[model samples]
Target chain A: MATRSRALLPISFVVLLFLLLYLGLYLNPRHESDDSPMIGKLAPEFDLPDLIATGDRFSRADLNGQVSLVNVWATWCPSCRAEHDVLMRLAATGEVPIFSINWTDRPDSGGSREAALLWLGRLGNPYQKTGDDGENIAGLEWAVTGAPETFLIDVEGRICNRITGPLNDRPVPNPENRQEVRNNVGNIMKTVRKMVAGEGKCLTQDS
Target chain B: MPYSRFMNGLIELNKGLRMMQKQLIKMVYLLLLLWAPLSAAAPIDSLIFETQLQEDRFKQLVQEIRCVKCQNTNIAGSNADLARDHRMKVYEMMKQGKSDDEIRHWFVVRYGDFVLYRPQIEARTWLLWGLPLLLIPVGAWLLLVQLRRQRVQATEEAPVVGALSESEQKKLDEVLK
Candidate 1:
């Protein structure tokens, strides 16, 4: 009986190890949502040229004293294109000012400063002002990994939330998925309203 | 005489072959040495730091931070535009006299612990760092217990040499007679 029990002990230990390993398989090592630690912190400051009006400059000071969405985008990013219509719709609502940073619009990377202006011209210019971050100096400060990341800044210029992916209601391109599309935009709007009301520190999707 | 001459020719040929092989190896080694530094050196960006120390720190910092776009690669090693931007950010911060901790903190604030190659040892990471230490002793103890048990079992199963069975003794006596 003792030998039988002893033999079973190692097997049980192995089973436990496998169980833990199986659990680990479900644990995502990479952070999902709420990964941007920039939430609740002061937004990084930048001064950049306006994408449309090259003579004019867009700076961090412009975001002060207003609840705004600073969207990091570029002509090269397809996700940015995907979110442009949503941004236009949001702008039509006139709920909040949408500032844009044209991130990494260098010609070599299939991005041109002129192309950004052309996009805005064609897309109806949803942004109050578009900053041309040609050299990505401002983009780096904001820790922008890619285009179509939106940062919600409160009246006090503090970043309240960061949306990493495209700001579409439906992540999928299918127009038929109307239900999924409604929830995402509504959620963003609700969060923005909450931030404006000074109800939350950082109202992110996961949080 | 012709045989001896043939032997001498063969020996000369062997000597020539050995010399050529040595020279080839030497040339290969020299080429490898020349290529080594080029591969080791990361591409330097246009942004320059004030001092060599600052530049070195910038390089080290970029390598420490993970590129969000290229999830598997460090910003310094990635050629993605975002990685380039991150590298520039690190350089800019270093030039501004930011400490290593401060720069790392800046990235952590923006990108969470995932941005760091070496995550901070905190409450959340206790298991990640402590598992090996905990498992090693447990494994050793289990091995020791199993070995001791096996030793005891072996002793029990072995025949008692001095206290032989009566039938075995009778057989031995008959054989001796």
Candidate 2:
């Protein structure tokens, strides 16, 4: 029995090593461990003029008293364009209030307030309120690598989650690959519902 | 006579091979010289700093910070717009008299610990920082085990030094009988 256990030791170790590597495959670079550290922290403060209404200001305090979504969008970002419909679908549900930051709306980035106005005019605006960020003053604070990142903020103005890529609800055709797939909108809705039930503080993800 | 000629032919063939190998090595070295600039120097030459101290700090900070967009590259080496923006931010902060720690902490707040090139020795990074120290003891233990095995093998190979002679064996047998 001692010899048998001794033989099984290395075998069990190899099995564990293989299992770790297999689990590592699912732990992609954008895995939960790589999730933004801004989670569970107060939303970064920024006071900007409204994207549509000229006189109105939108700031961190505006996000208080309710759970809401803050999406970063720009005309130059095609992914933002692609996910506009998802945001529209999500907005129609009235599950949560959706706000936006018109990130990098400057001439150099091929985006301007007029272009944004035209795009929203054509595409139908889903944002409840849009903050103009021509100089990307807020983007730097929010750690925005690029446009089209969405944030979920709780009632107290703490960030609950941050979605890095375009939100999608498309079905994964292969069931076996489901573990790697992100049902972004569905998951966001689930989190939103849980938050509405008063549990929106960012839960520690066990990655 | 023919065997010597064959030997001479083989010698000439070897000389030719050696010459070709030398030429190939020279070509590779020349190609590598040309390839060096593209990887080492990116498009960050346009940035202007006020003083040498500020410039030095900017350069150091850029290398010490990771480019979120590129993930693998330090911000100094990445040509991505975000990296460029980060470089500008670092320069701006330095001009405003922000300390290095403050600038680094600012980035940490925005981008998290991943932004740092050298992560802090915290609970999450204890394994990463302590790995080299951990390897020292492990290596010492492995060497000890290896030395012990070698010593065992050495002792087994050496013949018994004081074996009984044939006369002694016979005397012992007679005594026993």
Candidate 3:
């Protein structure tokens, strides 16, 4: 009993120290959500032929004086479909120009380019312009891996933010699926507004 | 003497002819061996990385780093196609003569320091690197305390063994005798 009692304090100290060490080692990687990868880099330069036949090409130069969101999506991507409403609403805000980069879509793969055109036609064109990246040329240039990824390019043609999933701005959150919400459209707008008002740095590279 | 010389010349001529046939046969065999590969499997002229090291080191790096998509699995092991694509990107960068630090820096530029598996030892990570060193002394002290307790217990139990039974004593005597 005496021996057991004598050893308890050191043992407890060691256990506590180990626990503290592990906690410190493991917990250091997490950061706040608004920390995005595209925050500070110059937006990838692109000049894709417009998909909508709006008689104008979609180019980074066109967005020089405005803050815009470039959403990389495909009709085939279910998450894109899910996030469609959020994008439509964000577009309705009309404060920021929202552009869509349509990625590779096959007919058997949910919706093709024709189907996407039809869907957009029926839904009312929310974007000022759209680019059809059928061969994934823009995707490779932007280092885009898949669809439903969004980037917030500031007025200076610098990529200010990149949200790697679907956006949800509704008060009641959609049931969480495989793609966790990276950034909501509302949050992105708030950040852009703050940056424009000179309230706080928008985590973007100044052109 | 003339007959013997003629016979010797005939023998030399036969030897030359046999040599020529052997050479021809060898040449034909060589041609066949050269033609066999072309006749069968399609020519795979592409460079492929078939070795484990090429795959594992990249995987090891990715597993340690968090996926930008899924907050859990490292980008290397994540089933997310994005994660696979990131692994491929890392591999391609490594091939392009980028050092591990440079690759890490590239990710940091985009994702910030949150992408690193082992966060750099900086103002925010002093405690992380220091904790392992700190545990050593604590572990040693615990071991010392346990060993001392064990020694004490051993010493305390020694007295009980001194009281031997009479039957044991009789057996001992018998063995001695």
Candidate 4:
């Protein structure tokens, strides 16, 4: 009996180690979905050259007094291409105006402003104003990590939510129940509606 | 004469093998000498700081900050455009004479704690910091308990000296008589 229990001890230890390793598969060490520190803070300021209309500037001041989305995108990013159609659909809804920042179109990333303009011209232009961030100056101010990241700004120009990755509409599969998962567009709209209703307050601030 | 020729061939072979071994050692040493400078070479050379201290701080800051796009590598080690922008931002802030804490705070406000390579000790990371400490003692105790149990079992299984069974004792007494 002692020998059996002794044998079981190492086996249990191995089982525990495996369980911990298995748990790690589901654990993301990165921040939680809604845990972006930029959320609820004043959106970063930027003044950039317009992509389509040369000699025109798109500034953060224009975002004041309205709910809007600031989308960071680049011709170099494949995910931006994937999310372009969803952005077009969102634009068609006219729920909110979107401002675009074309990031890293300079020589290092092998992207050019001309390519960005041609891309928008071919795909329908969904932006109210498109900022050409060839030097990524505006991108640094906005703390943009990569393209296809969208920020929702409230009426006061405070950032409400930051949606990382491409705007996806695929239904999340559920084996237990076949309920459709809310797509990125749907989620954005829901938040926009709430903000429009004057309920979007800064989580960090008392006001 | 044939035997002597064979002996000479063996000695030549031995000399050739030694020469190859020396060449291998020399190659390894050359690689070792080359590796340090290659790894220590700065990633970004565009930003020129006014002072050496400021430049050192910039180097330290980049290593501490994780590249969000790359996930695994720090901004210093990553060639991602975002990392470049981040490095520029850090350099700009350092030029502005912002303290290290303030610069770190600026990133934390934008990217969250995930941006930091060394996460602060907080409510969320308690388990991350404490788990290894907890596991060490638990693992040691389990090992000790197992070892003790194994010793006990070994003693029980082994035949004891001067302790015979009843039949064996009777046979022993008859032999003695």
Strongest candidate by TM-score:
2
Q: How many clashes in each candidate?
A: 0, 0, 2, 0
Evaluate every candidate with DockQ and list the scores.
0.57, 0.56, 0.23, 0.56
Tens-digit lDDT string for candidate 3 (B1-177)? 999999999999999999999999999999999888555522222334557775566556666666766765577546554555566677788778777778777677656677787788789888989999999998899899989989999998886557679999999999999
Residue A167's lDDT within candidate 4 is 80
Question: Across residues B33-74, which tens digit of lDDT does each residue of candidate 4 receive?
Answer: 988756874575577878898888988999999888888888
Interface CA RMSD, all predictions:
1.2, 1.2, 3.9, 1.3
Model 4 reproduced share of reference interface contacts: 0.90
Residue-by-residue lDDT tens digits, candidate 1, B1-177: 999999999999999999999999999999999888657646557875578887677778887999899898788877787787777777777777789999898888778898899987799999988999999999899899979989999998995668768999999999999
Ranking by TM-score: 2, 1, 4, 3
Model 1 Cα lDDT, one tens digit per residue, A85-169: 9899989999989999988878878989788888988889899998988898887778787777888888778887677768765
Residue-level lDDT of model 2, residues A45-145, one tens digit each, is 89999989989998988998888999999999999999999899888988889999999878878889999999999999999999999888888988888
A1-207: candidate 3 lDDT, tens digit per residue: 988997898899899999989997787455445455555667767888788895668877876767778888888788888888888887888877788888766553456779879878887677888988776656655656567888777767777666777788855444474234346565567677876776233453332
True interface contacts reproduced, per candidate:
0.95, 0.80, 0.50, 0.90
Name the regions of candidate 2 deviating beyond 4 angstroms: A1-33, A171-183, A199-207, B1-40, B45-50, B137-177
Question: Which parts of model 4 have CA positions greater than 4 angstroms off?
Answer: A1-35, A169-183, A194-207, B1-44, B121-177
lDDT of candidate 2 at residue B23, scale 0 to 100: 100
Report the C-alpha displacement of residue B103, candidate 1, in angstroms.
Answer: 3.6
